[model samples]
Target: MKLLKIIIVLIGLITIISCKNEPKSLSDFKSNFYEIQHNGLRLGDSLNVYFFENEDLVKSVEIIWNGKLLKNHTIMDSTNTSLGINNLKIKVNLENNSISGETNVPILNSFKETLVEFEVVKEYPHPQELFTQGFFFHNNKIFESAGQYKKSKLVTYNLGSTNYLQEKKLDDRSFAEGAALLNGKIYQLTYRERDIFVYDEKTFELIETLKLPSILKEVWGITTNGKELIVADGTQNIYFFDEKFNLQRKIQIAGYASIYNQLNEMEFIQNKIYANVWQTNYVLIINPVSGAVEQYYDLASLSQTKGSDDVLNGIAAYGNNILVTGKNWNKIYELSVK
Candidate 1:
C-alpha cells in the first residue's frame, strides 16, 4: 500500500510539472513578435518580413506560406503568386514556448491594360424615367433592374419596344442595384438594403430573399457564370458567392497602376468579367481568375444626355455584341468591340 501511495504521489508531481511547462497557444501572446511590413501587397512587389529584437525569447524562426515552409524567402513577385488571397504563417520557437502569427498576402495585377476600340452598332428605345442599374438579355428579351428608393423595380421588355412585358416593383425601402438570371431564377441586388431578392424567372414571383454578409459595405453589381454568383461593392474588391449568398472567395480588382474602385453593374461573358466603373465612361474587361484588367473601352460619346447623374452604368451580352446604357438615359446603345 505504501509503494502504491508513493507511485501516486510521484505521478501527481510529474503531472503538475508537465502542466506548468507546457507552452501556450499563439492567441495567448500579448504582443506581436514579427510583422510582414505591408499586410496588403501587390503582385511583383518586393516583400519584407521584420522580426522584433527578441533573440532571447526566440530560438528559431520558420516562415510557412500556404502550408509549406519557405527557404531563403525574399520577394513575393508574380512568379510565386497566383493572384488572390494567400495564407502566410510565421512560427517562432522559444526555449519553453512556440507560437505562430498568421496574415494574408493579397496579390494585385502587375501588368497594364490594353485600350480596346468599340463602335455603336444600333440604338434602342429605353424608358427615360428608368434609373438603369442592371441590364442584360435573356431569350431574345431585354431584362432590366432600375434603382431608387420607392421606385426600384425589375422589368422585362422587347428589344425595340418601350413597353414592359413583365414588371415587379420592390418594397418601398429596397433600392435595387443589379440583377442576373441563373438556374430559372432572377437574383436582384440592393444597394444599401444588403438583401438579395430571388424570383422565379418565368412567373416573376418572389421565391425568397437572402441577406448579404455584414462584411460587405453595400451590394452593387452582380452576375453569374451559370454556377456561382459574383458581386461587386463599389470598391476595389469583387466577391464570389454560392447560391445561398455564402461567400466562397474574394479578389481585389487591379488595373495597371492601382486598385480599381467603384466597380458596378458587372456582366460575365466568355469566361471574362466586364465591369462598369461607376461615375465614369470606362468599362473594364477583367480576367475573373486573375482579377486582372486586360482591356478597357471608353464610351463617353454614346450618351447624348449631359446630366452629371446620367453616367454610363449598364452592360449586357447582346449575341456577339454588348448593349450599354446609362442611368435615366433614353437610349440603349449596342456596341461591337474588337
Candidate 2:
C-alpha cells in the first residue's frame, strides 16, 4: 500500500508537470505500445512481443491483450492474444519490484503476405547418409557441413561428377552448424559452442579457434558480405563483425514467424540474406535494410511430410538458379524464381 501511495503521488506529479513546458526523453513520459502486423499473418496466429520499463531493466513484462495472458518463453504472462485481422488494445504492466506503471497498446496489421512452396527435383548424387546443417556452392562444387551428436564433419563434393572432394573432422563432439569463406579463411560456427573454428580456405586445415561474445554461446549460422561477417544465434538476432571479429550492431528480425522458426543455414546472395527455418521446409528471403522478409520459398515437398516432401533445410544461390537441399536428402535442386 505504501508503494501504491507513492505511485499515486508520482502520477499526480507527472500530470501537473505535463501541463508545463518540459524536456524529457521516451522514458520520462508514458509510452504507447503500437500493434505490429503484416499481410503475411494467418488467422489465429500469434507472435513474440517485448516491453520496456526503463534503462537496462527490460525483463519479464506482463501484458494483457484482448483480456488474456500469454505464457510463451517470450511472453509468459500471455495466454489469449489476438490473431488474423482485428483491432485490439493492450494494457502493458511494468512491475518495478513493488511499483508499476500502465501503458497503452494500439493494434496494427500485417505488412506483406508470406509465400512458401517447394518441389524436389532429385537428390544429390552422393549418398553418404548424414544430416547436413549448412550447404554452399562454389564453382560448381558443393560444400556440406554435417551435424550430429558425434558424427560431424565438413565435407566437400563435386556436383558434376558426384565425387568426394575433401573432408575435415571436428576435434570435439560439438557439431559444426554453418561455414563461410571470408577473405581466404573459413569461419565456422559450432552449435552450442562458444568456440569458432577457423580453417585455411585452400587446404581446409584447422587454423585456430576464436571465442564468441562472453555473453552468448549458442551460435547457429554464419555468412559473409565481402566486407563484414554476419551471424545468427539461438535468438532470432543477427550480428555483424569485421575481419577482427569485433562485435558490431545487432539486427533483430521481429515478426510472427521469426519468434520460433529457428533461423538456420544462412546464405548471402545479391545483396540480400537468405536463411532456412530449421526442422521446416521453408526459406526466408529477407531485406537487410528494413529486416522485413520480402519473399519465402516453401520446400515442404523435399522431405515428404503430411502434404509434401520436406527438403527445405539449406539454401544457396548458384548462378541464376536457387538451390535448396535438406538433412540426409540425396537431391540438391536448382529452382527458378516464381
Candidate 3:
C-alpha cells in the first residue's frame, strides 16, 4: 500500500510538471494586446508602446516601423518616419508562441507652418503655351520642362530674352516633367515614363536615357545641388540620387500640423529645398536634413495675376530673388522674400 501511495504521488508530480512546462495560449494575442500612448506619433516625436496587462507574458517585442526593423521597440522613434501613412508591423514573442500584426501609423500633429510673405522683384515674359512642369536658373537662362501627353518638351530661354535658345521636343508617349542642369548635363524626368533623359547642356542633344527606380511611382520634380539629384514624386517624399542615378536617401516634407503632399516642382538653393505644393499657392521652404518646413511663402497674390486660373507650379532661385510662374501663365513674377 505504501508503494501504491508513492506511485500515485509520482503521477501527481509528473502532471504538475507537464502543466508548468506547457506554453500558455492566448486567443487575442495578436489582436488587442498592445496600445500606443504618445502624441499621435508626430514627426520628430518618440513613440511609447506598451502591452496593457500582458507585460509579463511578453518575452520580446519586435517592430518594423516605416519599412525598417526595430528590435525591442514596439514602434520605433517617429523622427525617422515618413510624413503620411507610415507602415507598422509588430511581433511579440512569448515563451513558446509567437504572433505578429501589421497596421498603418496614425501620425497626426497639431502645429502650423510659419507664413512668410513676399514682394515682387520683377516680372518676366513666359511662354503662354508652355505647360511648365519644371523651372530653374542655370548660368543666365531659364531651363523649363513642360508636361503633356504629346506636347512635352525641354526649352531654354534667357531671363529677358523673348526667343528660346534651344528647344527639344519629346515623342508623343513621353510627358516631360522636371529638368535640372547638373555637371554640364541636363537631366530631365518624364512623368509615368520611368525614364530620365540625359542631354548635353550646350547643344541639348540626347545622350542616354536612364531608368528610374520602381519605388518612385511617378517622377514629378528634379533638381541638383551640384553633386546629388533631388527628386519628387507628387507625394510628400523627396528622393536623393547620385550623379549615376543611384538612390541615396529619401525624405518626407512635413509641416507642424500636417504632412505636406503634392510636392511638385523643387529647387535647392541656399542649403534649403523650396518646393511647390501642387495645385496650391504655397511654397514650402524645407530643411533638407530633418525634412521640416522652416517657412512657407504664399503665392496667392502672384497666382491671382495670371491670365487664367492655372496652378502655380514653377520656382527658380535667382541669387536673392525667387522667380515663380504657372502652367499657361503669361507672366513670371520674380519675388524678394527676404
| Best prediction by TM-score | 3
lDDT of each: 0.82, 0.62, 0.80
Q: Write the per-residue lDDT of candidate 1 for residues 1-338, one digit (tens) a residue.
A: 99999999999999788657554554434334234424446676665544434445557778777677765345676456656556778787877667778876656667779988888899989887889888889998989999999999999999899899999999899999999988999999998887889999988999999998887989889999988999999878899998898889877787766678899998998889999998888999998877889999888788555776778888999888999898998898889986
Model 1 stretches astray by more than 4 angstroms: 1-107, 304-308
lDDT of 3 by residue, 18-127 (tens): 55654343334333423442245565455544554556667777777767776443433444665556776777787656767776664643356688877887898989
* Residue 84, candidate 3: alpha-carbon lDDT: 55
RMSD each, Å? 7.3, 11.7, 4.8
Residue runs of model 2 more than 4 Å from their true location after superposition: 1-110, 114-123, 126-128, 160-162, 255-261, 304-311
Instruction: Report residue 81 deviation for candidate 3 (angstroms).
Output: 5.7
Candidate 2 achieves a global lDDT of 0.62
2 or 3, greater by TM-score = 3
Q: Write the per-residue lDDT of candidate 2 for residues 225-256, one digit (tens) a residue.
A: 88888887856567788766798765545444
TM-score of 2: 0.65
Task: Give me the candidate number with maximum lDDT.
Answer: 1
When sorted by lDDT, best at the front, the candidate numbers are 1, 3, 2
Scored against the true structure, residue 187 in model 2 reaches a CA lDDT of 83
